[model samples]
Structures are given as structure tokens and as C-alpha cells.
Target chain A: MNCEEISELVYDYLNERLDADCAVSFTVHMDGCAECREQVSDLQHTWTGLADLPQEEPSSELKARFYSMLESQQVAAKPRPLATWFQNLAVFPLIPQGLAAGVLLFAGILIGAQIESGENVDELRREVRSLSQRVTLSLLQQDSVSERLRGVRFSYQSAVYDEEVIIALIDAVGYDKSVNVRLAAIDALKPYLSQQPVLNSMVTFLGKERSPLVQVSLIDALFGTNGGETLETLRVMSNDAQVIDSVREHVRTLLEESV
Target chain B: MNVTDVFSDNELMLRVRDGDNVRLGMLFERHHKKLFNFFLHTAGKRQVAEDLVQEVFVRMLKYKHTYRGESGFGPWMYRMARNVRSDQFRKRGNAPFDSANVETVELADERPAPAELLETDQSIGLLRTALAQLPIEKRELLIMARFELLKQDEIASLLDCSVATVKVRIHRAIKELSRIYHQITCEVRA
Candidate 1:
């Protein structure tokens, strides 16, 4: 096969799907042709590099949502269309619907009063932020991995970087069972890395984080701290036998660049 | 042994089609993450990717009766995923790039420091941006061929093209990807 023909079959050859005779012919061409060999090598390297890009696991909420959806689908699949229709009609009646509408109207009026005159918008926003942080903290403590991922996301969206949120995030990075949630925690902590506590939490987590993805993210986040402390932490991590080789190499590079 | 252990994906899917709804969970466990990654890489958004994964399985359930049990389940699932994604675009009347995570590209650009890993990640990010810049068809083809580990013939089957055509398209897609990746990286370096 000429280079052009080999190029067409290169990926197939690299993927090892070519038939035995074609594969031998391809190999014979590679033996005689340097340019084709280089082309195949470059393609192989690119393919390998693409594979090395970390595999991102979806957050646990996806599984939960899938199961819930499957359950509902199965329920809907059951032969009860007429029964369900009647049940819905019987349940959604006039008097209770009116009562529900009245309650909603009353709540709307109350909310309008609060928005208009109860407090300044900034204060109300502050209250909302605080409430969200509290909820985030509670969610972070939940056993459900998806809930914890949601909590980490909430922390990212939070306007307030309260110590509690930071601590919860730190704990998550250090101890979350799911790598996805911990990775989310690493992302959620990015904005707060400027704060001493957050930086300290990241540095502390660096020592304990076992996942290569989390370690790389933490390394990336802390690489900008611009101090001996960050370098020192990286230096220690670089030499740690437990740290992955790729991470250690990166840390060493960070050390050199920082110097 | 468990039924999942005893059956291939195609076989399991056949069971799923034949009123054995529980077998779908086995398939979900087998392929959902792969599907999620495919959508994540394609869409560049976790939430959207997750939703799309869910949507693919839901479509699989809805369309289970149509499985001919001929092609491998991976290719079939990906075909359904592509349909789900396109159907979404049609329903929303928005282009695929409308929801591209521009913030991620910006985040990658923000880190200007010179560490090997950082540079590596930045390169990956640049590649991602380049992939995003390609027309959606080229990007999807490259993603399935490279990342999803689908064979050329399988992809051709999925795309309804000849295997030879899929090979050249994938090669051209990689060439385009390399060009865009280097162009973006050079701009970043400059």
C-alpha cells in the first residue's frame, strides 16, 4: 500500500481491526517507508494522548435520576391508563384547588410585601445566600453521592464563601467516597483559593487526595498561590511515592517554573 | 449466575425488549458512563451531558421494540444518543454550540503559568476548544472514532456510510482537529 492507502487504513491498523494479510502488507510498507512510519507513530501518539485525558464520571445524581426515571417509566408502562386518569380527575377537585390557589395568593402577597418593604434587596439576598450555604452544608453531609455533588455545585454558585462551606468542601475533597463529588469539590473550591483558609484546605487535601484527577486539579489551583508554601507543598508531593508519576512530574515542573 | 452475567449486551437488550424490563438496568450499568462521557465530551456541560445520558436510555426504553438485534449495542446506543442530541436541537431550535461551555475555555486560558501538567491540561483544553469549533458532524465523528473506541465499520454502520468513507472522514477529521488544536495553541502561546 502506498502512503495514501496506508493513511486511510492507518487508524484501522492501529486499532488492530485489519485482516491478517492486509496487516502484513501494512507492516511491510512501514518497514520500508520512514514517512509512513512517522505518520503512523504521530497518529498513535495523538490517539494515546486523547485516551489519557481523564475519564470524567458523571455525578451520582445521574444514576439516581435514571433509576427514578426507570421506575416512573415502568409505572407508566403498567396497564393503568384509565385508572390513572380517573385517579388524577378525582384527586384534582374544585374546593381543594380553590383552597390551594388562595394559599398561593396569600403567599404571593406576603412575598410581595417582603420584597417591597420588609428589607433591602441586598439584605434579602444576603439572607438567601446564608440559607443556601446552610443547605449546601447539610447536603454535603448527605450519604447520597449525587446530593453531595449537588452540594458542591451549590457551593460553587454560592455568593458567600463562608468558613463552613469551605470546611465542608475541604472535607469533601479529603473524604468523599465518590471521586466525582470530590472532583466537584475541587472545582467548587477554585474561586476561594485566594483565601488563606481555602488555600490551607487545598494544601491539606493535597496530602490526602488519592485520585490522580483530584491531585492534578489541586495542583493546578495551588500553582498560582505565589509563595514558598505552595512550592514546598508541591515539592513534598512530588517526592511522595504514593503520588502518581504523572502528577509528580507535573509538580516537579511547577517547582522548576516557580523557581 | 445473574442474567446480566450470562448475556451479551445484544442479548440483554433482547431480553429488555421481550418484557424483561429489569435487564435494562444491567445495560445501564454497562454503558451509561460511556454514554455520559460521550455526551460530556460532545456537549462540554455536565448537567446537559447527564440529561442527555438519561434521555438516551429513556429513548432506548421507548424504542426497545425497534432493536433488530443485528448491530452491536454500543453503536446502536450511540445512534440513539445522536438522535437524542439532534432531536433536542430541533426541539429547542438552537445550535449545538449554543450551549458550549465557553467558561471552560476561558478557565483554561486564565492559567498562564508554565508547568508541564498545566501546559498539558491547557493543551487538552485547547484541543477541546478546537473540537468545539469544528462543524458538529466532524466533531461527533472524531469523538466516536477516537474516544468512544468504536471501530470504523461500526461507526460506518452507525452513520450509514461505507467503512472506507468512514475511515477517510475520520482521518480528515483528525487532520482538521490537529490543525485547529495547533492553531489555538499557537495563538495562546503568542
Candidate 2:
């Protein structure tokens, strides 16, 4: 090793990363070269001096502030439950008894005759499905957690398994701030697990979800969809150290049962 | 082994990205002290260093999705810290190294007899003053390499340069630091 080579490998030598032959060569070169030896020694001293600089401990307020900010952000991200909106609406004055009965009677006669004729039954079903889809999509977008929960319930009940509704429910499963809504969305998606998009979304969301309740529900929902892939995902998740113990244990139990 | 010990920085960061954002507490616990010291050495004020450390963590959360685990979490995090420091300096409309904070020291006509400077507390103080006098980029390189114990390749990744470039810069940085340390030592002796 020449002086230039020593300059190039000096850091490596200092860090002890140079191999045995190169290290020996470096030592031999340094022994013979006073200039290289002084330079290396000076650099080494500077490096050591830097380590002597006192490490200042940050104030306790830093930790307190960080955790408080985290808590606030988590709280802000939570979606409000929709049930509150219904409770507010319940305080409104009731409709007049006679007027309510009259409207109900008129609607009953109109719907009764339509069903009796049965000519537009398929058209009516389509209309109802379209309306339900609209309602489900709208409710899912609401700010109230309960309303989103209703949307998830509406999604499955309407049997309106369109691309838009599936996407909405998939989003709820992945991004909903409320655990109840996410759990409900997972349940709504259970029957559709055989579908590629729904299955893929669930599998992807399963990896991203941190809540043990939601994770366990997702695992249950995905249990038999594509047994091989599901088992593999479960097995990987079962061993994941990031996963909470309860969820991992649940996964392990399921894997053992499958065995 | 403790449960938390089982979780690596990357794993904790990945969890943060995946909506287990509270896991960032663990990352913060592991890195905040070293990061605080890095900022203190670079920024030269305790308050400013604390603010920078806070900003880095906030940015980590904001940009959590961008963490791909391609590099170890240390390099990725220090990269963010560098940006936070740069942005702060930019916002303040000042250079990263404030000349006002650096005390001028005259270079000696000749090298002082190699006293055991590195061994004394007063010499350590002078060394710190020498460090503060270095160009900001070179000071940062030395801090990361020596204090933070970041490897050459890791520093390269953080600086978006190659390992060879990092090596050259580090060598030059240490040489500059040594020159300044000697100058300060002479100033003190005079």
C-alpha cells in the first residue's frame, strides 16, 4: 500500500473493516511512512475527541410533548359515530298522528296494488338496488362512525355487490377510524372473499391493520378464501414480531387447527 | 428478551407506516438522544436542537409511507434529520453555520508540540469550539461518522452520495477539524 492507497483505505483500517492482507499491508506502509502515520494518528485523535463531547439530555418536556401530540393526532383521526346524529334527530317533534297514518295508508295501497300486478317487479328490484347502492355509498362517506357502520350494514343487506360498493367497503376495512366499522366492513366482505379484488384488498389490509380485533376478524373472513395463500399469509403474520401476542397466538391456533 | 427488544427500528417504522403509529414512541425512545446530540452539535443551541429533533419525528410520521426499508432505519432517519435542519436554516434566511456563533482563532506559525490535548477536559472544550468553526457540511460529516457511529455507506446513503465520496469528505473533514483544533489550542496558549 502506497501513501495514496493508505489515504484511501485509512478510514477502513481505522474502522477495522480492511481484510487481513490489506490491514497488514496498511500497517507495513504506515510503519515505513512517517507522514501517513502522523496523518492517521491525528485523524484518530480527532475522532476520539469528538466522542468526548458531552451528550446533552433533552428536557423531559420533549417526551411529554411528543406523546401528547401523538395522542391528539390519534384522537383527531378518529371518525365520529353516526348514532349521535340519529339521537339529535330524535328530539324533533313527531309528525301529526292522522297525517302520518294517511300517508302510510296511501303508500301501502299503492305498493300493495303494484305487488299484486307484479308486472314491474324486476324493475322495482333494480330501482331498490340502485337506491340502496346510492344510500350505501353516501352513508359510507359520512363523518359519523355510526353512519359508516350503517353503510357497511346497508352494503351487505342491499346485495348490491357493485364495484363501487366493494371499493367503498374495502376502503372502510382499511382506513376507517372506528374499529366497529372496520369489523363490520370485514363481515360485509366475507361473502365476497371469493372475488379477486375483495380477496386481494382483504389480504393487503390484513397486513396493514394494527388492531388485533380487526386483524382477527380479517383472518376469520379470509380463512378459507384461497386456502394456500391465506395459510401462507397467516403463517407469516403468526411469526411477525410486530404483531401483538394475542393476534399471533390466534393465528398460530388457526394454523395448528388447519394442520 | 423483552418484547420491545424483539422489534427492530425498521419493523417499528414499518408499523408506524402501516397505521400502528403509536409504535413511533419506540423509535423515538431509541433514537431521540443521539439525534438530539447530533442536532445540538450542528445547530449549537439546546433549544434549537430540541425543536429540530421534534420536527424530524413529525416528518417521519408525515412521510412514514415513503419509508421502504431499502436502507436501515438509521440512515433513512438521518436523511430526514438533514432535511429538517436544512429547511430550518432556509426558513430562518441564514446559512447553516452562523459566523456570529463561531469564535475567530488565529492559526499558529508552527505546530504546537503534540501535547496530550485530546486527554484534557479543557482541550475537549477547545475541540468543540474547533468543531463549531468548521463548515456546516464537513462538521455534519464528522459528527455522523464519529459521534453517531454511522458507517461510510450509511452516511453516503444519507447524503445521497457514494461511499467513496463520503470517505473523501470524511477524511477532508477530519483534517480540517484537526487544523482548527490546533489553531484553537494555539489561541488558548497565547
Candidate 3:
């Protein structure tokens, strides 16, 4: 209740952070002391001002500028002749609607009895399968190995029904010819690292992986493993200092639980 | 909105995940002002605050794919914000605070200043200055607690600290605030 103790309690009292006994004592002290009461009021008022401070709003121009910046940065990363090939294959995303339109046209023609030559009918089927072949062939024919790997990745994340998808992801980890593509594939597959084989392979590689980028991906994969053994590896690798903090924080929580 | 409402933050995040730019637009409309102010209060500079908020959203976009659906979306977004903020301090090469500066609150003021008494409102400058002088960790916790209004457990998760540690830090932070407030008032009067 004296000036020093009461003043110290002023903040905790305002925040409701003091223990019950200390709160009771602080309340009693404030009840009789004019100076202490003023201190409490000032602290409360200061808190109110701090609370009322306004947020910064980005103006319209800034938002547009930032968006343009992002788009330009993405544009800058556009791959070489590979980007041109994508320009060709990119239209494939709209194929469902195109196919639907074609189906509607075919149904109308058939219902109206607008008969075509039998050769024309066979040629249409041939054309459709031919288009499918070219699409698959174009993916295989990409000049950059990474572009083909991306096609594999596309199949991996999107076509889960295919057994080859996850297998491609794992195979990319150790086999992809391009480092960057391998890095992307490994990072992307981190979502499924809990899969026992993925965990087993990542840990096996993490033990002696010299490439920091691959080690980084393995660290991300290790998170799904959930235990001290993984933490032990990260703690030992703390010498890298680069990824140490990222590793250490997880390790810190692990070490805390163990102790 | 209720967390599920069309206007809710979670809905906006879901929209962002689904590639709905208009919903992301609404997310900016809803949170931009509030988040921007959080940095303004914490950094005490509009440009820095604006840059930090912009960087937060940029990082948000960069890491959008990593957002797992397990937690409430608000905490996840703010946790991202907290990381970006701490990363700013680290990049500036400021080391951690000395514990001595943290052990106790300084006492110098209880008397009201004329500027405050006349309007029945305290000078915001005092509080802002006081907050700026606090250690980055303490300032971060207090700004997040005061602005985002997260409870101790949520703050703990956002800071990646224990709940007890959050409680201790926040208690110390508020005490530091009161101390800084008093010091500012004394300096102004003197």
C-alpha cells in the first residue's frame, strides 16, 4: 500500500494481471491514497490512448502498385522457351467448357438429323485422340527437364487416384535432374510427409545431406514426424546457424517437454 | 461476421484459397485499417507501419499454400503477422533486451497534466512514446494484446511461447508501459 508497492501494482491492477491477494491489497491501498489513485487513473488513461491509436490504411494507388509489383515479379520468373510451351498447354485448363460446347453442338446436330459422312465421323474421333496424343507428347518433349518434372508434379498433386503421383514426388526427391525442380517437388510433397515411406526417406537423406536446400526441405518434412528423435537431428544441425533458429524453436519445445 | 458469415475473415481466407480476388479485396477492406494501425502504434511511424502491413500481406500471399485448415483462420493470419514483425527487428540487427531494463516499473508521475485535464483525455503522445521505448518483444506482445485483443493463450501461440511466459511478458510489458507513461509526463512538466 506504500507509494512504491502501490505504484508498481498500478499497471497489474489495470490489466487484471495481479494475483487475488495482491489485487485486494492494491485495491485497499488505492482506496485511501489520492496519489496512488491518480497513478492508476493515469495508467488506465495511457492504456486507452494506446488502444485508440489508428491503423494505417494503404491508399488505392499503393495497393495497385504492390499488385503490379507482384505480377511483374511473377512475370520475371517466366521460363524460357518453356514459357512458350506453357502458352500452348495453358489453354488446356478451359478444355472442359470447350468439350461441353462441342457435346452440345453434336447433340443438336444428331437430334436434328443433320447426317454427316461416315468418314467425317471417324475423322472426328481420330482428331480427338490425336489432340490428346499431342498434349501428352508436348509435355514429354519439353526442352527443360524441370518443365517435364512440373508436368509430373501437376499429375501428382492433382491426380491423387494415380499411384504414380506420390511415387513421382518421392522419385523427384532423389532422381530429378534439375535441382530447382527437385526442390519444388520436395517442398510440395511436404503436405504428405506423414506417409511412412516419405518420412523414412527424408530422415535417411537428412542424416548426411550436404545440400542446404535439400536439408531445408527435409527439416520441413520432419515436422510431421512429431517426436524427440527429429528434434535431436535438428539440434545437432544447429551449427548451420542459417536454419538453426527455425530448427531450434521446434527443438526448444521438444527439449522442454523432455526435461 | 460470425466466423462463417460471408463477410467474416475466415470466409475471406477461404475465398483467397479458392482464388476469389473479390473476397480477398473484402479481406483487405476489413483488416487493412486495423492491421495498419497495429504497426503504426507499435512502430510509431506511418511509413514503417504501412510498409510492414504491406509486407505482411505480401508474405501472406507468398505462403498462402502453407495455411493448414486445423486452426481458426484469424489466429493463423495474425501469427503470420507476428512473425513478419519480429523478422523486421531481427533484420535491423537489434539484439535482445537487457533483463535489468525489465525487472521493475519506474515511478515518477501520478499528477495529471493540464493538456489531459482540459480535455478529460490523456495526451496520446505520452503513451506512443512510452510504447516505442519498450523492448521489441515486450512492445510486440503489448501491441498485439492491445490491438488484436487476443487472450494470453492465443498470444502464446502467436509468439510461440508458453502461456505462462506470455502472462509474465505481458504483466511486465504493462508495468513497463505505466512506468514509461509516468516518465513522459514528468519530462513534459519539467
Candidate 4:
């Protein structure tokens, strides 16, 4: 082996880590070479010297300092109120982030009111809607005309689009004493116009209705449907003199417009 | 201490990374002394060694996400310790190979009692002085191989070199340290 190769084997030889064949070769090389042997002897002494250096113990204060530092870090890492709120928000689905902006804006008030209440969110939302529906139903039964009008307006807030609410609104349109409440009922029912029962009720009301404005509103409500039955209803209402001139004129214009 | 047997170091480190700070305490108890001795030998100052040990755990917490559980924790932590040591050198605006003021640092940490100082062997003191004078690369290799007891293969991985290269470097470093120690002992005798 070359001097360079002998030098590489010296560490393993001093540590007694050389493989069997390598150990034999290393001994043969060293037996023939004084310079490499002296080098190995010096390296052995240095390795022993390094091993003799004291294993110093760190000061006791170090442990105290480390625990203190860890404690401070834990305190710093604790989540704050704003971060907790953000974490709660992050739990919501991302699709809602795009389309739920208006829902979020409305729910934001509810969240603020119920923060830390630990109630189920779906349960809370259902509770709010159910309470609104109950209040609408109760107001519909009030003796005061204005209270019943409020009941018609409140029905619009029904999240479920409740059947009782639809029935109550139809009753308002057909039987309520105040024309304004009946008009409000038509406005409330506008959202449910796609329902077959609402359309049928409005068409049935057309023949017996006395108020020109209510008749006009119903005609306009049904005008978009533009069914053959709606056209016939308008035609019949147009000929009735009891219907106000303006109402009759509107129907004639609507009928003419439809054709 | 049995915790070390219960779970592997990587699992403990992963727990620490996953935000179980208590697991860090377990790891610290397991490896702090070895790390302390590494820093002590490298920096040659008890306070600096203690501070570096603290700094390593802090950076581990800060940079936990970077750790992938692919390798053993020892090499990963030693890599971070090297980085922490390098960052300190950068902040101080100095290269590590510059003459270390380690004698003054060692003297400042604690004063041995008069009898204890007299009883101290001259060769051990001379050895430490020789180690301090060796270049940082050679000193670190010797410290890792001789004191830290890391195998040649682990040192090779740590230095990003072949195992053959690590053996050659370690042999050369030991030779240089011997020459330095002899020169110091001669000067003392004179």
C-alpha cells in the first residue's frame, strides 16, 4: 500500500477497528515504515489526551433558564381570542367562503350574540327559524289588522317556506278585512308563486274580488305565468264594470300585450 | 429515561413537531448532556454552551415543519446545531477559523479552587488548549468522532462526504492535534 493508503488506515488501526485482512496489511506496512509508525504513535497519544479532558457539567442555573424559556414560549404560543375566532371560521367549508358572504354577514350578528355558548350551530339556526315561524303564525291570529299585516310580512322570514305560513298568507288575501293586509299578503306570496296551490288560489280569488287594486295586483302577479287560464281570468275581469276603470284598462293592456 | 426505550427518537421529535411541547422535555432530558458537551467542547465556554443548547430547542420549535421523519433524530439535530452555531458566527460577523478567544471564555465561566487548580494535570489542560487552536473543521471532526462517539459513517453523512473521506479527515485531524499538543507541552517545559 502507498503512504497515502497507510495514512487512511491509521485511524481504524489505532481504534482497533480495521478488518482482518486490512489489519494484517496495515501491520506489514507499519513494520516496514518508521515514519508512519511514529505518526500512528503520536495520533494515539492525542486521542488519549482528548479523552482525558474533563466532562464539564453545565451550571445549575441553565436548567432553570431552559424551563423559564419554555414556559415563556408556551405563553407566547397560546391562541388569542381573535385567532380562536379565525380558527373557528376556518373550520367552515371553503365553498361557503365564495357564496356565503351575505349569510356570513347575517350570521355574524348571531355568532357575536352566542359566542362561547357551546350550542350546536345547526340546532341554533333551526331554533331561530322555528321561533320566527311561530311568531308569524301567532301574529296572523291577532285581532288588530295592523298586527295581522305584520304577520304577513313576518312570513317572508320563514326559512323553511312553511306550509302553515303559505296557508295563512292565502287566508289573508281572501278573507282579511284590510285591503292593505291583503296587498301585503300578495307581496309575501310573490316568492311562492311557483307553487301550484298559490296560483290556483289567486286564480280562484279573481272572480269574487271587489277591490280594484287587489284585483290589479293579482293580475300582475299571474301575468308572468301567462297560462291560458290566466288569460281567460284577465279577459273576464276586464269586462266587469265593478272593476275600476284603471284596473280594467290594465287588464285590457295585459290581455292585448299577451296576444 | 425508560421513555427513550418506549418510543424512538424520531417518534418523540414528531410528537414535539406536532405541538406536544411536553415531549420536548422528554427529548431534552434524553439528549441535553450530549448536546451540552458538544457545545462545551466546540465553544469552550460554559455559558455559551448553555445558551446554544437553549437556542437549539427554540429553533427546533420554530422550524419544526421542516423536519421530515426520514433520518435518525441525532443527525438531524446535529445539523440544526451546526446551523445554530453558524448563524451565531454570522451574527457576530466572523469566520469560525479565526483565532478563538476560548482561553478567556473558559477562565470567565468558573474559577477552580486553588488546591483544585494545583491538582489539575498539565497534559489535559494542554490537550484542551491544543484542541482550541485546531481549525474549526478538524476540531469538530475530532469532537464528533472521539467525544461524541459518532461512527465514521454517521460523520460522513454529517459532513456530506464518503465514509472513506471521513476516515482520512479524522486521521489527519488527530495527527495535527498531536503535533499541536506536543508543541504546547514543549513550550510549557521550556
Per-model lDDT: 0.76, 0.79, 0.60, 0.77
Of candidates 4 and 3, the better by lDDT: 4
Q: Judging by lDDT, tell me the better candidate of 1 and 2.
A: 2
Task: Give the C-alpha interface root-mean-square deviation per candidate.
Answer: 12.0, 11.5, 13.6, 23.4
Q: Give the poorly placed runs of model 3, Cα more than 4 Å off.
A: A1-42, A54-58, A66-259, B1-4, B86-122, B149-151, B162-165
DockQ-based CAPRI category assigned to the predicted complex of candidate 3: incorrect
Across A1-259, the per-residue lDDT of candidate 2 in tens digits comes to: 7899999987777677899999999999989999999999988888788877776778777877776777677667655534554465466559687866786687678868877898469767865775687578768868899899889888976654575577678778888999999999888888878877678778878888899999999998898775666777898999999999999999999888877
Q: Best candidate per lDDT, number?
A: 2
> Candidate 1 vs candidate 3: which has greater TM-score?
1
In the range A1-259, model 1's lDDT, one tens digit per residue, is 8888898787788678889999999999999999988867766755666666666777778877887787677667766544665576567667587776786687677768867884659766865775686578768878899898889888865766565577678777877889999888888888878877667767777877788998898889889887567777888998999888999998998788866
Worst 10 residues of 3 chain A by lDDT: A156-165
lDDT of 4 by residue, A97-182 (tens): 65667766766877777665755586568657756865786688577998998898889788666665776688788878889998
Report the lDDT tens digits of candidate 2 across residue range B1-190.
1222335788878988998776776678678889988887788677788899999998888899899998889899998998999999899997775446764322211236365644476776788788888888898888888875477778888888999999888888888999989888888889
DockQ of 3: 0.13
Clashing pairs in 3: A55-B37, A56-B36, A56-B37
Off by over 4 Å in 4: A81-259, B1-3, B94-100, B107-120
Chain B fold agreement for model 3, TM-score: 0.72
Best of the two (3, 4) by TM-score: 4
Model 1 CAPRI quality: incorrect
